[model samples]
Target: MTTIVLGAGAVGTATAWYLRKSGHDVVLIERQPEAAMETSWGNGGIIHASEVEPWSQPGMPTKIIKWLGKENAPLLLRYRAIPHIMRWGIEFARNCTPERFRENAKSNLHLALHSLKSLQEIGAEAGIDYDRATRGVLKIYRSRDSLDSAQRSTDYLAQHGLLYERADPDRCVELEPALKDTKSTLAGALYFARDEVGDSNKFAQGLAAACAARGVQCRFGETIEKIETRSGRVQAVVTSKGRIVADTVVVALGSFTAPMLAKNGIRVPIYPVKGVSITFKRAAWNAAPTMPLIDDSKLFGFVPIGDRIRISGSAEITGYDMTPAPARVAAIIANASFTFPELKRYFDISKSKVWAGLRPVSPTGTPIIGETRIRGLWINAGHGHLGWTLSCGSGRVIADLIDGRDPGIPVPPPQGVVVARAA
Candidate 1:
């Protein structure tokens, strides 16, 4: 069968790769000149399966309310986005209950672990050189209360085969010597020994090349204008270049998936949560830490990719706004420097690259994958902040469903999300 995979980011490229391997003629479409030029680019670079809890945990509403409009706050809600955010906000709030959060975390962790394994296999099979490291990830907390809260979640994940260890301040510095400078501020840390980190853009590009080598037609720089349907199934995709007929169409457009599918009478409740990242050249090989580190108190992370260090974090509840806020970018830099003080001297804004991309977040924080209500139409989107972490696994699952085979992973429709079906 011929299949058209929309949006050639990590998710779409992975989907195309798996589908071609499954004996299907695949075509990948993208608006950018190349794959992974958007959200899949400049992410935190950690495949964090151990940290799969949804952001809408208990007391989140109170935290968001307290952080609203604060300049250096971790989450910022723009006033202009209020009208567009109301419906999604209501659904998001409804999922904030403790019961719902745990259920969602369980599902997310299942996909995340599967994705890490898939990524490793792909890297080995394709010889993908993405500066990947299997040294695990360290998440440090500044307060005892925060560390205690994290331990609870860690314990829950431990029951499901996740390997982790709690580290005191001295042990935390011992794990990553770069943290030696910040020992005064650190309280404790949790290390996930199995987590991995790598450059996602390089992985996406490498996978896309592999897909092309396997006879998948890649149509980059073409904007998809519409998805045509007939008799309750996808017929063709109308693009700025031309229309392409397909027996199956998979939507992986990230935050843009909602609007494109809405035109086809499918309402996917994905909100555009904007995030920022800055990548700078490492001063010296030994100056940066080898392992990925997340600062839970500051809500940012530091990743060493080859000779470069990526400082990324900060969630802005803005609607489709990709403008790079200098303040927010500076805040990320400052927060990251607090954890790795040497970063202050090495980070040169003139030479560094800063980026902002919208994460297609579902209220429940679980990705929506598999056949939708429309026959021959499928979705593998709304992975949110875990898009890179879950990309390969989600793509494999969608390919399995497209081939009418068992996905081998649990995939249920997102709770309380109202998706319109075909008549």
Candidate 2:
């Protein structure tokens, strides 16, 4: 059976690998010249299971309201995007209750752990080296109250196989000596020992090469014009080059999935939430911390990937715009310095590379993975900011479902997409 995997980002590339491994003829398509060139390109690179809590957690509505129009806010909602995100925002609000937040966290953690295992397998099989750091991530909190609140979430996730330890101010510095030159005194921290970091773009590119070497057809630099169907079944995908008949079509187009599928009258709850990142060369910064740092108070992360450092964070409810906001980038730099002030003395901030990409977020915080209402049409998208963290697992699950096997873990039911009226 020939299966068409759309969009060769991290998730789509992984799906093609698993599908080919399952003995299916797989063709992976991407508009870019290579895989992971978009959202997967410049992420903070932390495959953190500790950060499973959704953005719609308790009291988040008030926070979003207060953050409205603030350029430097952790989560900003541009006034122009309000009209486009109104319906999605309502569903996001609906998932903000305490009970729902915990349940969503549980679901996210399950997929995240499974993804890590799958990623290890991929790394070994593909022989790809992606500057991996195994020291784990340290999340620091400035206030005792915030630390206590985070502890509750971490403690609950611990029951579901998350390994973590509560760290005092001294332990926080002990975990990462680079934190000793802090600008302000830290209240406490939480360290997730199982979390790891790596360059996702490198991994994706290597995996794509592996897939092609294994005889999976990889057609990059091709624009998908439409999905052709007959008798309510996925018949083929019409691309700019030509139509390729397919037995199954998996939509893994990240933030573009909703619009692409909506063209065929299939509506998904996925919304495009923009995020910003800045990468810097670690020139002359010999003492850069090996372990990733997540500042919970400031809502930013400083991750050292190889000889370069990546500072990334922010959830902007903006529609489809991929332009990086300089103000937001500067805000992230300032926030990152709060935990690692030595960056100013050691690294050149003027040479930082700024980037922005859209994260395809679901209201439930769980990726929508399964066969949709359309026969032979599947979905493996809406991984949100966890695209790299959840990529391989989501791909493996899609392959298992297509191959008539259990997905190893319970998956959300099919036909869960919200059908939208045609404009």
Candidate 3:
């Protein structure tokens, strides 16, 4: 059977690769001229299973309320987007209970750990290098309470084979000497030894190339008009070029997945949460931290890619607005600089790149992956901030389901994901 995969970002490209490997003819479609030109581009580049907790944790409601309208707040909810996101916001808050938060974190951690392994396997087999680094990720806390909370979370995740070590301020500095400047302010840090970092866009492009080499038809620069469905199954995908018939279709269009399926009366409950990242060219390679670092207090992180450093985080509840707000960008840089004090000296802002992409977030923080009520239609979106972290594993699961095999992973379907019974 021929499968048509929509969106050529990390998830879609990985899906196409796995589908072709599963002995199916696949066509990968992207509106951009190349792959990973959307959310997959300019990401934080950290793949840490230790940070798999959902954003809708127990105390998120209070935090959101506190951060409301704060320009430099880690998570900002735009008043203008309230009406548009009223339903999703309510559902998100509903999932903020302790029970739901733990469940969602476990679900996300399973996929994230699997994805890291999948990435390693793909890298070994395909010999694709995206400036991959194995120095692990260090998440620092500014408050003793936060550090203790993280230690508890790490202990819980440790049961699942994710290795983490609680480090004091001095140990953190020893782990990443660049953090020496922040020793006075830091309470402690958690280092996930198994986590990895790499350029997600480069990985997506490399996987797309591998898919093409494996005879997967990659049709880029084509806009998908609609997905025609009848009799409870996908029929054909109508693109700007023409209609292409397929036995199955996978929607991996990130934030656009929900709306696209809605036209066909399918609601996936995916919302577009905007995030910004700023990449600066480093003056000296040794001047920056070699390992990825996340500031737990500020909810931001700094990732080193070759001679550049990318500062990413800060969620804005704006509906589909990709505008790189100057203040938001500055906030990211400012927050990241708290950890790396010499950031301004080493960073060349003139040569920096600022980007904003809509993350397809779900109420539970877990991605909606697997077949829907529509027999031949599948979804692998709503990964939120962890899209790059979970792409390969999610793709593998989608392929396994389509091939009539167990995905061998715990993939609970999202609540209210079922569309009206297919006619």
Model 2 residue 391 lDDT? 93
Q: How close is candidate 2 to the true structure, as a TM-score?
A: 0.97
Question: Once model 3 is optimally superposed onto the true structure by TM-score, how far is the C-alpha of residue 78 displaced, in angstroms?
Answer: 0.7
lDDT by residue for model 2 over 177-215, one digit each (tens)? 888877257898999888999999999999999999999
For candidate 1, write residues 349-423 as lDDT tens digits.
999899999989988888888666677888889998999999999888888877777777676454533243322
Minimal lDDT window, size 10, model 1:
414-423
C-alpha local distance difference test of each model: 0.87, 0.87, 0.87
True lDDT of residue 414, candidate 3: 57
Clashes of each: 0, 0, 0
Model 1: which residue pairs collide? none
Q: Where is model 1 more than 4 Å wrong at Cα? A: 415-423
Clashing pairs in 2: none
